[model samples]
Target: MVVHSISRYLLIILSLFLFSLVIIECKSIKFSTSLSPKSLDLKIEKLTHLHFYLQAIIGGDHPSEVKVAGPNTSFIAFGTLEVEDDNLTVSPDVNSMTIGRAQGILASADQNELAYLNVLIFEFTKGVYANSTLSLLGRNQIDVPNREIPIVGGSGVFRLSRGFAITSRIRFIPNSSVVLVFGCYVLHY
Candidate 1:
């Protein structure tokens, strides 16, 4: 009889403990609604245009881009991966006013064509947008005269930025170097 009474008391205590835990968890839980830009006092800013040249020195003693991994293949090295810290300049010349660096990885994804999967970050170091960065993730077809890549996100003055960058190969040398011009149209707030 005493054992049965003790078991009943234990069961009641356990039930009370579990109920208290559930109540505590319910009190801690927070349900929030979605907030709008107006509620946050954020205004949409003006659209901005940025033009620059990306100078990639490929095969010199001080190359800006290098193939980190790839199979021993032909000139069009498919499945190859290259990492670059190319110079973003105002002009096509390597000695032009430096704006930033296109630092990222590019992989030859398409086996049939000259298409590269580019995952790059445009890190600005000069002018009004200094210390800012814009992330770019898209496919770049080298054979195309004008390739458009989407600018995904950004920081600093370019926070919440969305845009597209038109890339055109200005100059290319066989096994030497390549210079590409980028015209970026961005909208941010």
Candidate 2:
């Protein structure tokens, strides 16, 4: 009789445990966001990865906010500004940076070229990286007035191999004194 009673108790416990698990699993959820940009006006050929704080002087302010999408993935924006720091040199890790291939350059249906900056993921043991261009891509231009833009959809993943701080800068000289300073950064996985 005692053995039968023990068996009944075990069955009840197992059923209760399974029920609890089902309830928990049903309540759990997951979330995600798309990084594809509708439009990109700049083709940043040379990207110079700088210390988070050092980029401000040269117009490197990024996204206006930071967002958490998951436990391991988060979205944060650095500031945008342009600084002419001759002392600043290309990051040795990625010195020979090419925007067309490096940052994943691609063409849209409109024949508009788009470069994916955020998707450039690289694994680093905490070193610096940098790249530059003779001029920002002819078709793509960065206007300081347009402060915030989406980072997604491109030919390559520039900052995705590993988590690292990235700083992008551009210099443009028109016929006049209107020098446009544009830059931004991302702390991504």
Candidate 3:
């Protein structure tokens, strides 16, 4: 009789446990801004892998704001990035292949070292005002050939983007001016 009673108790416990599990599963927390219990699913997608070159002209007279704070200066630079199959120099004009532009600011301790935030705006027929913005925090040492920086967040077309940008010095003109080429690859949703 004792053994039978114990088996009945065990069965009841098992049934109660299962009931509790169902209740918990039904009450799953929804990740959303709404007060309702409805859940919001996240969307996963890939943006274009924009391969372009920034023919940026640095050190005044261009469309950039540069404030020299002794050896470490701060600046805001803007330039054109032409789209091409390979990393070759191109004309900075409104052409059929003209994809976008590189517009941003940079804080530098030296000529080759900087922290920058750049926005790349695509001027394609379909994309129109689509843009990819990036935050680059790194040291572009004079000896280092290139610096790969992070493309953080963005707006318009490039929403919630995360990726990397590469900057390589193409030319250093007279009077501390420079021409830089920036290549960006990003993923957005």
lDDT of 2 at 128: 32
lDDT of 2 by residue, 85-128 (tens): 22222232223331222221211112132222222212222233
> Looking at model 3, which ten-residue stretch has the lowest summed lDDT?
79-88
What's the lDDT for all of these models?
0.92, 0.30, 0.49
Clashes of each: 0, 35, 0
Question: Model 1, 44-157: lDDT tens per residue?
Answer: 777999999999998879999988888878445898999999999999998999999999999999988999999999999999999999999999998999999999999988
Q: Whose TM-score is greatest here?
A: 1
Off by over 4 Å in 3: 1-43, 59-65, 71-99, 110-139
TM-score, per-candidate, Cα-based: 0.84, 0.21, 0.49
